[model samples]
Target: MSRIGKKPVELPKGVSASISGQTIEVKGPKGTRSFTAGDDVTITLEGTTVKVTPRGLSKRARQQWGMTRSMVSNLVVGVTEGFKKDLEIQGVGYRAAMAGNVLKLSLGYSHEVNFEVPKGVTVSSPKQTEIVVEGIDQQLVGQVAANIREWKRPEPYKGKGIRYKDEYIFRKEGKKK
Candidate 1:
């Protein structure tokens, strides 16, 4: 009954998958990643394809069916192409730079904010106002970008701050004088 679970994940050329009990490991050009599904769902690898099915008609089983399938799909994509997040800084003198493993940010604060990059993820600053986060894990990449953005969130009035490349800021009208 899960639409997404009904579609098996197809592994592209140069990609392979292995299953051990409730865990499935996907190896691709980029890297290898694994996921462990709940007992409510069963995981199986057929040829180069991965499939997920529910164990019973229970609600938890149905919920895990689609979620497990999506997790498997993410693992495949993560190991193959990886994930990337882009952020840009706004406002005068606001900028970002990379100093070895640390990301230096100048967002109108009194002092520069030094963000130490975590393991398994890479952060780059191609331009003074541009920041790029990359990694094989989608969750890690997104979390790193969010943590950076949290330093100086975009304001509704002027929209001046660090934000995702494609993120939109809803503007509000200024107070009448």
Candidate 2:
């Protein structure tokens, strides 16, 4: 049995869920989101809670049981609290700024990198070195942050580049003269 699947997801205040066939839709103050589960699992909404169960004893069914439960939980949270990812730029003269729908990044490159902000997500630059990505979808928020960081990943030597705020870079000793 799956431990996570055994626990039903509770709907918070002002949040509602609807189930149709294999698809589940959740709506809250922030927004609305939907997820479709595999045939191996069944989804049900009980009053203010959501439950997920496996349809059989097969391995795939068991796997889907846990995954389906987690996906449902994410939908609830996403509609309620949403998701956020923060990135920090490090290095001399490296900075970030927002120009309308574009994110301007200076990562020691010869020219500034312009990143277009996609819909359903908001990108903000609170400071020259900080970037915040916010959205109702967790996957989209994370993917956008990763794409921005890809422009200049933190190096081990000088650690000069863009990285998540909480991320730690492993330092490497320089070669002897």
Q: Which candidate's lDDT is highest?
A: 2
Which runs in model 2 stand beyond 4 Å of their true positions?
none
Any idea what lDDT model 1 has?
Answer: 0.94
Of candidate 2, the 10-residue stretch with the lowest lDDT total is 68-77
lDDT of each: 0.94, 0.95
RMSD of each: 0.8, 0.6
- Per-residue lDDT for 1-177 in model 2, tens only? 899999999999999999999999999999999999999999988899999999989999999999999999999989999999999999999999999999999888799999999999999999999999999999999999999999999999999999999999999999999
Superposed Cα RMSD, model 2? 0.6
- Each model's TM-score? 0.98, 0.99
Best by TM-score: 2
Candidate 1 per-residue lDDT over residues 1-177, each given as its tens digit: 999999999999999999999999989998899989999999988888888999999999999999999999999899889999999999999999999999999999899999999998989999999999999999999999999999999999999999999999999999999
Residue-level error in angstroms, candidate 2, position 165: 0.7
Question: How many collisions per candidate?
Answer: 0, 0
Query: What lDDT is reached at residue 125 by model 2?
Result: 100
